[model samples]
Target chain A: MSFAHFSELLEHIRARRSPRRLAVVAADDPHALEAVLDAVRDGVVEPILIGDAAAIAILLRRLGERPDRFRIEDVADPTAAARRAVALVHVGEVDLLMKGRLETATLMHVVVDRSSRLRTARVMSHLAVLEIPTYHKLLAITDVALNLAPDVEQKHQITLNAVEALAAMGVVRPKVAVMAAAEELNPKHLDSLDAAELKRRSLAGDLPGCLVEGPISYDLAIDREAVTLKRYASPVAGDADLLVVPGLTAGNLLVKALMFSAGAKFAGLVLGAKVPVVMTSRSSTALDKQMSIVLAAAATRELVHG
Target chain B: MSFAHFSELLEHIRARRSPRRLAVVAADDPHALEAVLDAVRDGVVEPILIGDAAAIAILLRRLGERPDRFRIEDVADPTAAARRAVALVHVGEVDLLMKGRLETATLMHVVVDRSSRLRTARVMSHLAVLEIPTYHKLLAITDVALNLAPDVEQKHQITLNAVEALAAMGVVRPKVAVMAAAEELNPKHLDSLDAAELKRRSLAGDLPGCLVEGPISYDLAIDREAVTLKRYASPVAGDADLLVVPGLTAGNLLVKALMFSAGAKFAGLVLGAKVPVVMTSRSSTALDKQMSIVLAAAATRELVHG
Candidate 1:
């Protein structure tokens, strides 16, 4: 069954036989470690902290946790810590990866390295899952934090990645709304044109496991009254499970607006990787980071169960 | 003083000594007439209805009002009604225009017609003003419904138009935030590049009467905590008055997300015309339409007083 709230994901993960292994690269970051510890207390994840051991121990002790209570990998340098995290993934010692105090580029560099076994054939894309109070169900927005200005091909890949990730979370045949400024296919707006093409491909069974609707405005996508008022007929209208934004700019703005202005709680991860990657911004709240850990663990459980 | 809420705009307009004449093109539409009637009751505008006279009279009677209570221009054809509205503007018989049953393109065609005498030297753009509960003050987002994928030069023009519109609303030297996916100046995202250039030009005194900050994310633009967390130093951060979007897609999505998800109340008008135009969508709430009328009347009062 699909989850409606982020809290539901924690229950789903906890029902599993045991906690999933999570590797925190450059794990001395205070906020990241706090979230990891919160998830550990929630009995969802068994985190392997990879960073400066002294720093991690100091942070853990400062938080009133014993250093010997958790696994700590001593890799002082951020790049080496990223490599160590990737190695743990390759050896099947970790089920997922989370970025900590290190720069995202450093961690991503190790993941995408030619020799790294973590690279998947699919293009890696970020998927943000938001629990917006105004929306009836959890909504997923894609490529918000990654893929600056993806073209049609990249958007196609991103859609595939999101669909697969959603499937792993038990949301079969999710309704996907390819977002644009308006419902009409205006030639001046490439987003509308791309949306039409994506919908066509979806109808032809090219993009699978999702009922895709396109060139739909945000109001029509989430507001049932708007759907009725505008006379827009689509199964996805006002009940979209996934919203594929035109680009990162729109996606980022939409996600943050919901979180900051609409009081939405969010958790996001990088999909299309061999393992889900928790890459929330440094400015993200502690609860958001904890939710990401729970989401990663839940997705991992689904994959293993299958 | 600038308006912090739409209700304040009504006060500003009602304070005026005389009501301004408003021309409603193709005014047989019920919702449009309802809003016009509301404004009339509020004593902000004297509306001249230009459309099918018999249908307008029937609608007025249905709404429990007499047709002769207001001036009625008997132009049945939508195109001819648009022309008549522009002609009234040319002769200074009306202070503003509002779209009714006719297509926007038809009204825009007449307004931009070479002989229409209503075209201004500036590029016409749509400005949406929102009063979000989470934000301390009103925020304005631009070019959501008008410009599609504006280039750097067009963005510069759009910013100028927004600045002028804000000034007319008593917002002097407003803080303008050029929105991007992230605060960093990334070359791959042309929005960031354009934002950097806009900031440079603003600092160089090319764009005047505003404090411009660019390459700023939505969170930093409106969230004080995010600004402190990210250590982003900008006067506009967390207190932006105007948010200049990268293009129409982002702007539309941003505005709709705030209105639909964040519970924001919004009113918008088309600037750069000889008179402000209330061009809200057909599905816009009656309250929004009424507020747009109030906004237009207040802006007209400001212009006359200046």
Candidate 2:
């Protein structure tokens, strides 16, 4: 019941009994609208577009779509549009929230605001699912975009956020590799020490629904050939479903290297909120955006049901 | 005058008027001997093999080489071999050092010992040169295997060490990218702050022989398309000769990713000593080890002549 590719996630969302509602803040972006239209045509999600109505309509026309075919709300300013989108999620009108052509900080600022009902006690973290050509299945990495220099406690929350997201994708009991420079515990390496603590917590059943091992290196974590060559033994050695990085920098560099250099396609979303938030980079491909929406819809089912 | 590939580095070393003498500490490993023999056949280096004479002879014969063809010194233990290797360099008997069948910490311990004359006032750093298929030229990363969690002062030394190594490879003024998670200067990210300070110091003429740009992400640092897409302005944006990573973890993960996933070929050496030290990984390919020897030989010229 695990997703081997992003297209599988799309198929899972489409198989749902009804389409989930998605609130895309600042939806005037042509690239974002194109992804939305593809999802709409596939019946992945019902869109509630919140942005400049005139721009969205003109862009829709450019795509040869009727302006009145979908729901569009006009909010001129970016901040106001984000607030309106957050409000939609607060009242249970929208199952998911998305950021389109808007500053991620702008949307995140309102999503985490204390006054906003969307704010939960859980810490918000970003989860990215990558389809690497060399890997056997989809790989998930957490806090690549959010939570800079997260502490041990924050890392615990981030690990749980990614674990839950993976579970929602039908990956039961995912194997998580808490990565570091080396496998040994060195006092000078903060990441290694943090990884040891996280592994301890997971072993104690504190972080449930995942098998955690660390401080493992990247080669030992993913490459079976390396595991055999190095004689390193672990259940998660060559089959890690999730990689919980030490900080934002390592995760950011790892994912970008995978995409630009290693030929990987990825979809990312903000987890631990009341609803899954799709806040992809503007430089992301249209297929990436479409996959993010699909992933959000699938994760939303887990949030609403549980 | 610049090396765009590892084969070019090999040719540069082969073209040297005199082959640099390299002291191979604990040289009994078959893989290490295979690489050393390749370098010897190409007249890149004259190796002083220091290890168990019986084992070295057997390995040489296994490779179809005559035992009397090269100099072989018998040392039973790893620590003693490392000390003997350092003493050879201290007395100017050897121009470079190479590690074989010995722990890097053991060799580095003797290299940095105060009593060892090979020790200098400069900080020791590990520099790795990767010939990434997607990159334009040879990419150098600093402190990948050494200097864990270096402070601002130590980072300055590491940067200078890498710059000097590049200069030895005939890059007169190398472009160095001080990589971080993002380009913006955020207070929460310590690496970004350190990158900013390093950039400021480099501009103020503190770090000469290199143009330093910092607080940059991986995408903007190495990818020209990403640099143009984001419009990040810097002379080193897409054409970095050296990348000074924040710590050993980030650099280690990055190079390992490029090798395992991106099909990159790499060579590495330990810089900031009296002699260039080749301490490649045991799992490294024969070509990687050969390139390391070539790089060490090319870099030894600068150390000896400067």
lDDT of 2 by residue, A152-172 (tens): 999999999888878876789
Angstrom error of the Cα, residue B198, model 2: value is 2.1
**Residue range A178-290, candidate 1, lDDT tens digits:** 99988998888889999999999999999989999998999999999999988999999999999999888889899989999999999999887789999977778999999
* Clashing residue pairs found in predicted model 1: none
Candidate 2 clashes between residue pairs 3 or more apart in a chain or in different chains: none
Alpha-carbon shift of residue A179 in model 1 (angstroms) = 0.8
Q: Where does candidate 2 stray beyond 4 Å?
A: A302-306, B302-306
**What DockQ does every candidate get?**
0.89, 0.77
**CAPRI-style quality class for the chain A–B interface of candidate 1:** high
- The 10-residue segment of model 1 chain A with minimum total lDDT is A297-306
lDDT, candidate 2, B1-306, per-residue tens: 567788887777677657889899999989999999998889988899999999999999999999998999999698899899888876778988999998888988888888887867888889999998888788998888888788988899999988887787678899899989889998888899999999999899999999999989888888999899998999989888888888888888888888888888989999888888999887898999988888888776633542
For the predicted complex of model 2, DockQ is 0.77
Lowest summed lDDT over 10 consecutive residues: which window, candidate 2 chain A? A297-306
